[model samples]
Target: MRRLEGTVALISGAAGGIGAATARRFAAEGAAVVLKDVADPRPQAEELTATGAQAAGVVADDADERGWAA
Candidate 1:
């Protein structure tokens, strides 16, 4: 569906498992996706992008409030 065509979703813990699945599902539903993980989520993002999805990956430590201070 094109319900999310103009949406942007930021998903944490997206390197694998549920978060990864959610990102893929959202992309399929037409949302631009931002995948965040402590580990590198770039590969998953790139894979989504290759399928003509708008996606980006971010390495972040959600535990550290300081890290998010940008």
Candidate 2:
């Protein structure tokens, strides 16, 4: 059984670097991951999905309140 089965994780700056690594790790553990970043994270999300994870990529700026409110 996976540790994060039926769990959800929201990760910021997930388009690259540490955030991307975290996202991958979370997905591998069976968590549905939402990746938020100013840059498009669709490719990374798709990759996770291909590996049998439930994942989504959202483009937004964490520095902007409007970004999170939306």
Candidate 1 global CA lDDT score: 0.97
Clashes per model (N, Cα, C within 3 A): 0, 0
Q: How many backbone clashes does candidate 2 have?
A: 0
TM-score of 2: 0.95
* Tens-place lDDT digits, model 1, residues 1-70: 5889999999999999999999999999999999999999999999999999999999999999987997
Deviation from native of the Cα of residue 15 in model 2, angstroms: 0.1
Q: Please identify model 1 stretches exceeding 4 Å from their true place.
A: none
Instruction: Say which candidate scores most in lDDT.
Output: 1
Worst 10 residues of 2 by lDDT: 61-70
